[model samples]
Target: MDKMEIVEKHKLLSEKIADADMVLVGVGEEFNEDFSDIGRFPHLMSALEEVDIDQMLEWTVPFLEHRFLIEHNDGRLVEAYRNLYEMVRNKNYFVITTCIDENIKKAAFDTERLVEPCGNHEMLQCSDKCCDELYPSGEFSDLVKQAILDGVGLDSLEIPKCPVCGKPLAYNNILCEQNYVEEGYQRQWKKYTKWLQLTLNKKICILELGVELNLPNIIRWPFEKVAFYNQKASFFRINASSYQMTEELSDKGISIGMNAVDYLREYQHL
Candidate 1:
């Protein structure tokens, strides 16, 4: 679509969401557009460039653990998210995101209202699944940060061991083929699903922001299905590309191919 068309669509989409009785936000990697150093997958891969792909899991543990802590502790959220958060702050809202950077928490969104289905990096568990516990990673992340700051190789430092089983611990994130312990995440998931049922007839808006087409089942497809069935619900997608909605949802869906941050900036002013 042309610039003028996009601008007009943004206006209508923003209005629809702003007037919504309930807002459901779906976020993905693109939500971290500005915080590339800590949240970008490419940047994280660069940090493990020396390691072979076979040892990616072994190397990524420390790198991702540290990045998680750094991002969680970072005070300033990207302007776009901050603004977007404000737009839906007053509305009854829930967030489902694939991002594990914890930016939503940093933006001061309520934890109970947010769900990270992909798992978060700030927690670690035993690789062997010896225990049902998830440990806070503050100490280990701090040690890794200090080692990097001192210009020392991480190889010398001992990998964090599970206190219960004495086995090496892994980042709690859901890596490929890895076991994911959903002790905490499950609660939020239940809450979101319950909210979905309770708000079925409400004036809802499923806002998909910066999401990619890679994992439609996670948020994209589900949002579309929900909006398709709910006559009062609207599905609005803000993406740089691949913003097309399915034909079934065409009546209640709107797609704008624009950067999430830019669109949020425009929405914030209105």
Candidate 2:
């Protein structure tokens, strides 16, 4: 199909979702550009490259400042989220995103209905796994700023420590590879599961956006499973590539092989 055909195909998302009693959206890592695009945030990249941290800084700094990093990504992602919310906000919908940078949270989507199961940088956990206690992610921000401003290694700075065993505190994101403090998102996870239970016999619209096989079980495979069983489900799989619908769900699925951002922008234009 040509560009116009793709746009027309994207329009079906809104029309199809309108028929569903509930909408479910799964956001995956492919929706996000990699750090190679970090040139847009030169200052942060400089800090990350020059000031050596023990470990978590490599992953945490970007997320710590993602309000700036993500919001300024040419406004494409933020606009995409807004476009998505405009379509699904009024419905009984739940969004589960693997993008851990909190960019989606910055959108106007109902927070109670959103879950980031891969974890995010909003909290901190003990580097030594000393306890399940969590702290605000910003507790060490000043120290990071000082290290960057002074052009010194973070090891020379006093970092926040775990209250229990006095080990350094680490960002709670799964990317940082700390014990990760899964309990942080369990409440919302439960909410998402409960919402899925409600969708079993109802008309559901499953929007699988930019999902790759990187974490298939989380969004890709499970979405296929749901659509396969729910006779009333309409599944739309959107990606730049790899948008093939599972065979069992072919009868009820649409695979739009286009960039997720572009697809959402098409909705915005409509």
Q: Ten consecutive residues with minimal summed lDDT in candidate 1?
A: 33-42
Give the alpha carbon lDDT tens digit for every residue of 3-76 in model 1.
78977876786688778989999987676524444544444454455344436337545555456446444333
Candidate 2 residue runs with Cα over 4 Å from true position: 33-74, 142-156
Local distance difference test, candidate 2:
0.77
TM-score against native, each model: 0.82, 0.85
> Once model 1 is optimally superposed onto the true structure by TM-score, how far is the C-alpha of residue 108 displaced, in angstroms?
2.4
Model 1 regions more than 4 Å off: 32-35, 38-61, 64-77, 148-156, 265-269
lDDT of 2 by residue, 183-264 (tens): 8889999999999999988999999998888878889988999999898899989898788877788788888887887778
